[model samples]
Target: MIAEIIPQSSALTKKYTNFYITNLLILKNMGQVLGMISAVLILSAIYFRVGGQKNFSNGLFIVGIIGEILFIAIMIMAIFD
Candidate 1:
């Protein structure tokens, strides 16, 4: 009885582990892509402000800051889902 029960439990554990690994780890690529986009946007915003150095460039500076915040939020969210 002991020998028979051990094999069945081990088989069940293996099946569940495989299912989680196969289905759950595939979406990390999207997070990487989003992170890249976020970085680019922030950099561009900074570039715009630095190049101009005028009152008119304030909007660009704000955009860059917002982009950075959004990037951080996305990175945090990606870990759980």
Candidate 2:
């Protein structure tokens, strides 16, 4: 009976471990994507500035900043995890 319980508990533990790992993977990928998006937005903002679209450029810059913040948050979470 004890042996059966041990195997069952271990299996449950492994399932939970796998779930956490999957979530961590998703978070890591999301952070990477956010970083890429922020980079692109910054570049686009620069392009817009050169093209004289101040409004759109500003908007993109704001969004880019938000993305950068999210990326940073994810990085912090990763460090803690």
Candidate 3:
């Protein structure tokens, strides 16, 4: 007689979200925090310039804006492709 082997199903299924994510006081990874900081700095510089402040810093802020535009374009291409 040939015996049939029916494997048991997994009792430990994964949750929708990670355990750390579901819990409070979870630490954010460096990349996430840094990305948010960079985005904020870029936004603030643009806002200050739009508010009509004039100085050497304004030149730097303009350069930052150009760099941000290029960075965004590259990111979009990478993500789409």
Candidate 4:
């Protein structure tokens, strides 16, 4: 009984550890993608603003800010995880 429990527990722990690591990696990747998207949006917003499309530029700027916030939050989670 003791031997059986030991193997079972170790297997369970390994399974959970693998799951956690996989999730962490996914989160990190997602954060990176979000950061890149945010950078693009912001840059586009700047271009549009300079080109005198104020409305579209403002919209893109807002969306970029939100994306940046989400990216930061996700990165923090990945780091702490």
lDDT of each: 0.59, 0.85, 0.48, 0.88
What value does the lDDT take at residue 50 in candidate 3? 79
Q: Candidate 3 lDDT, tens digit per residue, 1-81?
A: 001232234333233223423332122233344445556667777777777765644765666666556556545543442
Write the residue-wise lDDT of candidate 4 on 23-60 in tens digits.
88898999999999999999999999999999999999
TM-score result, candidate 4:
0.87
Q: Write the per-residue lDDT of candidate 2 for residues 1-81, one digit (tens) a residue.
A: 222334435677668667777888899898999999998998999999999999999999999999999999998886577
Report the lDDT tens digits of candidate 1 across residue range 1-81.
223334545777667666655554444455566557667766766776778765545665566567567656655654553
Question: Between candidates 1 and 2, which one is better according to lDDT?
Answer: 2
Best-fitting candidate, scored by TM-score: 4
User: For residue 44, what is the lDDT in candidate 4?
Assistant: 100
What TM-scores do the predictions have? 0.45, 0.83, 0.36, 0.87
Candidate 1: what lDDT?
Answer: 0.59
Sort order, TM-score high to low:
4, 2, 1, 3
Q: Is candidate 1 or candidate 2 better by TM-score?
A: 2
Give Cα distance to truth, residue 52, candidate 2, Å.
1.0
**Who is ahead in lDDT, 2 or 3?**
2
